[model samples]
Target chain A: MNFDDTPEQARLRAEVRQFLAAHHDELAHGDGAYLEEPGHERVDELRRTQAVLFDAGYMGLTWPEEYGGGGGTNAQQAVINEELHRARVAGPVGHVGLGMCGPTILRHGSEDQKQRYIRRLLRADDMWCQLFSEPGGGSDLAALRTKATRHDDGWHVQGQKVWTTLAQHCRFGILLARTNPEAARHRGLTMFVIDMEAPGVTVRPLRQMNGHHSFNEVFLDDVVIADSERLGDVDDGWRVALTTLMNERMAVGGGGGELGVRSDVLVSHANRLLPRLSEERRVLAVEALGRVLVESLAARYSGYRLQTTLEKGEHPGPESSAGKLTAVRVAHATADLGLRLLGEDAVLARSRDGDWRWASAAASTPGIALAGGTDEILRNIVGERVLGLPPDRPRTPAAATATPIAESR
Target chain B: MDFDIDDEQRNFAQHARDFFSEQAGPEHARTLLAAPGEAAPGRRVLAELGFSSLTIPEDFGGVGAELLNMALVAEQAGRQLAGPSLTTAARVAVLLADDADRLAAFSEGRLSLAVLDGPPSGSRPSMDVVGATHFLALDGDDLVIGEGRVTLGEPIDATRGLGYVELTSSEVVAQDAQARWARARQVACVILAAEGLGAADRAVEIGLEYAKTRETFGRQIGAYQAVKHRLVDDWVAVNQLRSLVWWAAWAADHAPDQLPIAASAAKAYCAGTFETACETLIHVLGGIGFTWEHDAHLYWRRAKVDRLLLGDESEHLAAVATCTLHAADAAATGELQPI
Candidate 1:
């Protein structure tokens, strides 16, 4: 087993480094936080930055060239990812368009849909957001209430989606709606591509505790989508949705600073704060930081394992769940250390000081757990899928009837 | 770059696992627990499998495989709760690379060896040393090889023998061996951590298997989130340690500059993770787990001993913390690239 990249991979990494150095000003900075901008200027900047990567052929390193991908090896793709991560710049697009939606479409979309969407998606000519999670269904996504009815003209979609990221800026959405309510919960759902600016579609930003509006509450009031836009089969949405969900785990498992703060950032924070801390506090801080460093390294090495699997052309198993969970756990621990070091500065949310970055990171971590999957759900996935443990039995009507009596008692 | 062992090493590990299962599996370990006076019961089989010469030089009539191959077999050895024969022989063979006669005898299973590592003074505990012929030890910055008087300690995890030794006659094989000792300790940490990982992996599997079949309150206990999540967390810890172990072994072979920090991280992390895995196994097994008939305690004892074998978790963590800060300092000055 080896840790160092091969000569070819090293060359790819160097080329990426040279490209980033030459085009740093044109790319998204601070790990793509600027891409979350709520204005037209940010959209324009995103397109420009994405065009740079698309032009450089850095986008879609492992995707087929027929679909505007680089048609490269997974190791080469991993090298590009590592370089991008080291440069602390978000890649060509966010997780929604590049990581999740594009991959789903490439796999399950019709030939026409692939021809129409994949290139634009990769080029950021059209931004995308996922419209799967509903107000009533966050972790239980298959239980969504969104209804898409058949019509001669198209399908009319009516449902409310909460936590729709970048909905206001996205040109399209990869949506999951109930197509056959008479069918089983998972079997009845279908995946669709709906225009975000279509009539009767409204996007309202949700203010987070961190005071960011990165998420939204999207309302679809009888919005019409053409029949050709539907992805996968009529009732095969769950399978297609699985494709996206799998990619979501992989995307989040990569553990860029955009999802949550990286551990190296916390190490730097600890180093900067250690001298000012009292000797007693310093000991506690170091101990806490040690655990973070260890787990962070674990998360990283876990990513390497996943990359190895990909290189061998095997589908990653529940290792992604473990990786995402470990990343979130590291984020929580890193944030806790940040708050402890800040003491009073943690509460000063609007401060312009460097200490507030840690505070911001702490505040934003809850969203990380909510994204892709919650902590409990991922643990259940790991338990059942990875460990081969029996899954939690679904609650039956009889059990629900008895629950009222137990609650009253 | 691959982060996994090659197919040959993988097949060898599988062969080792099969050999241990038929020869020195948990049942055999239980018998050893019943009789702590037994020397390394699997020593002859271990040498037969050629694990004894995994890292020794080819000139010494050994396989001359790298450290990672030794680590892969060490993991399998840990899984079956085999004796410390593999650990002691692998370590001693590398430290005595210059002694062709001893190396050949060691490779041929004529020279039984035990190893001791500590601050290099007074008495230090060595495992599986009840009937070994020679003892290799560290003595205040010097590496020593000699005959020693062994006083057997009461067996806590009796899958292997444990004893403290006082060297009667010895020679300083290497003077001022601080750097070599550190490297040797790092190698030990990697091997022990790999062993702990193997044990931890088996313990979790056992727990998971029992959870699937063992029923409580009219349902399989695994169906309950509390039990399932605990098992899942333990499984995650196992993965964490597995990655660290692979990286540590790889670093030892291919990236010596990264070995010290990588091994410390693996040792520190594996100590806690392995214990958690064994504890989770016992908890999942419920009452039967606490009984002597159960193999859970064997793993528990192994974890407890391995945690303190070279240094405990906190000591290794301190080393990790120091390295972390130094790396950060160097990165700030652009002396080293931050990973």
Candidate 2:
């Protein structure tokens, strides 16, 4: 298992560093630390920086050049990501579109869909959200009751999707709905590219505990999606949705964690408290740091391990589930340590000097347990797909299982 | 570039697993535990398959393989959970990049080596010492190999073959033995961690099977979140252990700079992961797991011994912490520069 990048990869990384150096002011020094899911203004700032990245061919390093990418190896993509993360910039906007929706369209969408959607998505000219989960069924997404009746012109969809991030601003979404209710749950679904601005479609911002309004509850009432917008065959939505969700899992799992979830904060915090810490506390704090460090390393390396599998041209397999689970667990651990160390001040929001990152990371981690795939569902996926354990009963694979990290090889 | 095991390594690991499963597996463990004795058969198998000389340089008439190869096999040994001892690892390490002519003798089944690592002043229990003809003692800063008169002592891990050796005369193999000792320490950690990973993998596998088959509250216990989540944690740990073990093994070879830090991390992390795996398996197994006849306790006992065998988790963890602090200080003081 090699950790050092090859010379070619190193050269590419140097080039990327040079690119970032040229664009540092626009990328890293734009404003206060950008959140993972930034506000519209921050996203607009991110788009400008991402446009710089796109022009330099760092934005879509591994995607085919025909689709507005560099056509580079997966190693280059990994390097670009490492350099970007090292620079502390919020990554490009429209990650859902690029990582999940764009890839899914490239795979399952018709030729016209590819010609229309892929380049714009990669350039962050448009935004996309997943319209999969409903208020009735979440972890059990296959059991969703949204209706999509077939029409001569298109499919008329009526569904409510909760936890739809960026829907308030997105012009389009990947929607999953039941096209044939008489069939079995897994087989009766269809996937569509629904225009968010279409008639009878309404998006309401969901206020988070942290007072962030990034998540939205999207309501669809007979939303007429044109025939050209259908992603896959009617009543085969589960299969196409699986494609999108697989991309979603890898994007979420390997994308690292949300805002305020950086492990560095906790590490630096412990370092600061060390000189004054009592002997017992010193040992305790170091042990906790070591544990969290191990978890973080494990999560990071799990992504690398999965990347090797991608390089081998196989499906994402089970490690993404493990990655997702471990990522959130580490975030939770960071929060736990943050609270214990800060004591009464831990609950204070927007503390002086912006100490709220820790408290906010802790407060926002629960959303992770719900996002991507819920903890319980992810555990089941790991158990069944990764560990070869017998499922509670034989059925379709989890929505987030079997994706191959947005590339065929 | 790659973090996952290569196809060749995977095949090697598979072969090791098959050998252990067919030969020195749970049945073998039961046989040894019934009488509480040494694993002489396991020793013969190790020598027969050239596992004893895996890392011996080609000039010494051995495979000249790296630590990663050893880690793959060692992990399988742990998975089979029925090895006689990990003594082969120390012998391999002492002879790794060595000028010695011991590989042929070892591969030909003429010599068996036991590596005892601890303080040299006092007598401490040793492993891989049962019926061995050679001994390598890793004292604090000195590495010495000796032909010794020894007496065996009973150990909690009956298979480890713990004993004491009195080296009347010894040859100092390396004067500046720090590098050699570090390699030994790191490779040993990787081997044991591979074993830990093996134990973790099996314990979790057994627990998951039980969870699927065992019924409680009129349904399979695996249906319950409580049981399912425990197994998932074990599975996650196994992956973590697998990742670190591979990394530590890799560091032992190509990246000498990372060996100390990586080995400490591996040793520190694997100990708890292995221990938790056993305990959680027992939890999953319930009453049947508590019985003397059940195999869970054997792994649990091994985990207990392995955790403290190389100074406990916190000690190695402190090493990791110290390294981090030193690096940080070095950076601040300009003692070290970024690569």
Candidate 3:
């Protein structure tokens, strides 16, 4: 109920704001061109920025010091996020690593595994991507057909992971494979840290609808991963995946970008576009403005709630899905509105230069909705897990029995 | 920091549940709902169970409990659909909290009071005031109670049809209008929001169960994209409303100063969300849901009625605007102004 931060949190917020302000010029200048490019270059710049944050003891605020972190609390992390967002600083380009994989490893990885990866991941020396989704296995990921057989020094892994964000540049990845087919669909899976440069692995960047190479199709052949690289129990990869997925939901669903984006920027955009509109278009524009205003307010307050929950030592729950759902809807709506504002010019391409740039950005949103998790999948999760809805029916025997590789194509 | 309920509130909630279950079972609820006019038999049962005496001070032979305890019982009653007289009785107790003689009468089960304000539709016929032992009416700053004929509709579960009460203010007493309105609005908002919460929760359960068992297109309907998404959306809506309701209830019970904004927000959000959840449940359940036998209608009906009971969404929104902006105006102008 109390919206204001505690005195200590307030002081921390001031410190974060001060730090970002001091580094403002460097932060702003470094990412200028990459801001419009949805590719590994921007990600690399982001990683470099994260290194600066890590060196300054600001990267792992909520993680325990024993795990190569600052050993702060969740509230402190929220404070840092809010401040960084306010400063318009690009977050860690290795977000999949630092936000999801690192946290998952800290919690579920073996001590040796932790020691090997945690510090490097935190410092952005090693970038990571998730090798989970395949052409066949997506929302129904438990049905993955990827196999990993036990070998002398480790496991021989072979699988194709699609939708691997920044995989072409990633040095490491969290891979899920079928370790025991006899076990239940969920039970047979195993999690491992696979080296991207391993002999049998190939990462082919996939140009999405937006012409961005943010995702790739990663093909893994007879890649050897040491037993020490396995996270958690041998056949408990599902559990490890759950840890990563939970962190993913919290990180992505936390609606960080939505909160940090300046409302005035949008408002000014609307005002500039308002007078150029036809009467009918003007009405639509006004309605769009009102909707965005309400949505922005909701986003801010919801972020405050998340911050408060973290302050109270609670992880973001199903309720956090509300924030994500609202954000995507708002983003889609705003993007659509922007297209309307562009009117005849919206379809124009700034470049036949064959380079991915901001002019081609409008197409990225539908991918945003489909990526991380599709809106449909998120709704199911929110309903069933968060709202205690009934479970979906199990897939039929034939469908269930079909391997993901055979079914996907 | 404490989002979880404290030990005392938890215990109080548990006690309220136990008491209401024992006192307002299905049979009692059915009988109360079937009762006619102002002098229903359930009044004695309510009095015996200390429902009418909750707000009365200790000297008036009442338990003198917190407003939160009353809210808990109201919520449980809503969950069970335990007749409208309980809400009316609760409102009466709130109205008579500072009136010593009325509190004594209510405590001893010798007098009964029915709130003259009808449902939010504003279409109720003038109430018959003759039979009521006392009629409570809002007249500016005064609560005028006199012998009058009271005509009431049959109660159905936790809601009854409109009652027309004619009052003769033989004993007219003046109180602070704003204070009375504030107290009355708080009680109304809490009870109505509780009812909406109960209906929405039940609707989700019903829809979810139906989705699991019902088969369509060689798969359980729950697996279908449309059904799952709708159910999920409703679930999200219900949970959000639940959060707002709890926040409003807590504010009303503990921090009266914040009641105006909190209650309005709670009422506005709860009414809209609960109604949406009800409609979405029907769509998810499809044909069978529309049938009266499915129990979906029970919640749907309750949500529809409860939404307009305290005040509709628009009313509350206006109230919020008035409370927030008008108060800001007064403060800015350095003048004492009443909304």
Candidate 4:
């Protein structure tokens, strides 16, 4: 009910704002705009910037100090994120590694495993991707058919992972492979920290409709991983994956980007079209304006609620699915409105003066909807978890097992 | 920090459910609907149960409870699809609680009241407000409480008239004009929002159960992509509505300064969400949901009436805009923090 930050929280916010302000000029002058572009050069630049953040004690603010983190609360981390987002600085490119994989490893990885990877991940010396979903087991991940047979002093992994973001740039990955087909689908799986550069492993970039290679298809063929790389006990991979997935949900649900876009952009679009718009078109434009206002307010309130929840030490729950769904819906709706407001000019993808950059950004709406999880999958989560609806009937074991990994790979 | 209700609130909600289940059971509600004209016995039952006295101040010989408490009972009434006249009676009691004299009459079961009018253009009464000892009229800027002769809509029995009260004021019981209008609007918003919340809750419960049990294509209809998506959307809407309602109730209870903004947000969000939830539930239920014998229509009717109770969607939207603009102006002038 209380929306204002506490005194201590307010001080922390001020500190974060100060830090962002100090770094703002440097970031704005450097390869900041290139952060959203998909390229290895930008990834490398981001890694260097992440190291600077870590050196300044801002990276891993919510993580325990034993793992090369600041050992701060989630609220502090959220404040850091909000400030960084406000400053338009590119966030740590190792988000998947630090936020999800590293956290899972901290919970379940061996001491040696943590010692070797945690510091490197924080420093951005190494990048990571998730090798969980296969061609056949995206949503139904328990049905994965990836196999990792035992080998001398190690394990031989043979599988393909698809839709892995920045896999081509990753030095390591958290891989899920079936170690025992005799056990139940969930029980037989195991998690490992696989070296992406190991023999017989290949990563091919997959260009999305937006012409970005932000994701890739990873092929693991007889990729040998040391025993030290195993994340948890054999056949406990599903539990480890659960930890990563939970973090993934929170990270995705954490509202990012500009909290609210500039109203002037919208006003300018309307002003440019007001004279040309027909009477009916003007009416539609006004209605769209009303919708934009309501939706923007809704999104802000939702973000505020989430910020409050984080401040209270609650990890994002199934209710986070609502935020995810609303975010995508609002984005899509806003983008559509922008397109309509821009008339024929909106169809053009590129303009020499960047006048249509907003429209071009809107063009990536579908990709955003499908990125973290499909809109449909998010709905299922909301229904089953948030609403306490009954779980979907279990797919038959035979049919589930029959799914081919190649399709996902 | 606490998302779940406390033990006291939980017990209060449970007691409310029990009271309605016992007193306003399916058969009881059916009887009320079939006989909307009768007011004496129903009013007596409500007064004996202390429902009508909920909002009255303790000095007036009534239960002095917050609007939140009233909202709880209203929600339960909604779940049972209780008759609108009874709801209107509760609303009137809430409105009259601010006036010591009216509260005294309501506490004594001497004030039989109802909201009997429709929108501006409608000639006939949309709700049963007959046989009231006093009728409260909410004009644009005035509240006129008067004793009047009313037309009965149908026969609930001899003592009640399912009818509208045609105002024939012999005396002005209370007149605050602007203040009365604001109070009436707040009460209307709370009651209507609570009703919508109730309907949305029931629709979700029924839809989820049906999704689990009803099979199609060798799996529960809920297992289908189309149905699952729709059900999930309804779930989201329900959550949003719940949040807005609680915030609204809290504002109405403690922060009257924020009441205008909070109440409009609550009503607008609830109206839209409840309408969608009801429609989606019907679709999820498929052909069985469309039948007259099904209970879905009860919720649909309640949602429709609640949506229209206090200025429909557009009216609420305008209210939202006005409040938002005021907040913006205050923020600009450094009178309030920008939210």
On DockQ, the candidate that comes out on top is: 1
DockQ of each: 0.69, 0.49, 0.14, 0.21
Instruction: Candidate 3: count the clashes.
Output: 14
Candidate 2 chain A worst ten-residue window by lDDT: A400-409
Model 3 TM = 0.73
Isolated chain A TM-score, each model: 0.91, 0.90, 0.89, 0.86
Model 4 CA lDDT for position A313: 73
State the lDDT of candidate 4 residue by residue for B1-339, as single tens digits. Answer: 222334686688788788766655334444555655443236767677676677777898778777677677767766665543344644566566557876777776777666544322222453445445666665444555666666655432222234555666634445555575565576668666876787688788889889988987787787776888888887776666666666666667677776776677777777778888889888888898897667676566556656766666666666665455455556657999643
Worst 10 residues of 2 chain B by lDDT: B87-96
**Backbone atom clashes (below 3 Å) for every candidate:** 0, 1, 14, 8
Candidate with the larger DockQ of 1 and 4: 1
Cα-based RMSD of candidate 1: 3.6
Model 3 CAPRI quality: incorrect
lDDT of 2 by residue, A110-134 (tens): 9888877777777777788889888
lDDT tens readout by residue for model 3, B153-242: 543333343556655444655566547755776666766676566667667777788888788777678777678888776675565555
lDDT of 1 by residue, A1-409 (tens): 6767888888888999999899999887652232143456765776788888888988887888888889998888788877877887654545588879998999888888888888888888888999999988889777688999999999999989999987877899999998987676677889999899999899998888777777899999999999999999998999999888888888876432235565667777777778988888887777777777888788888778777878888865566877788888877777778777776666775343654666677778788887888889999988988777877866653453343221322
What C-alpha lDDT values do all the predictions have? 0.79, 0.73, 0.66, 0.68
The residue-level lDDT of candidate 3 at A99 comes to: 62
Q: Estimate each model's TM-score.
A: 0.93, 0.90, 0.73, 0.81
Q: Which stretches of candidate 1 lie over 4 Å from their true place?
A: A31-47, A91-93, A254-258, A343-347, A350-353, A395-409, B38-40, B119-121
Report lDDT (Cα) of residue A45, candidate 1.
77
Better of 2 and 4 by DockQ: 2
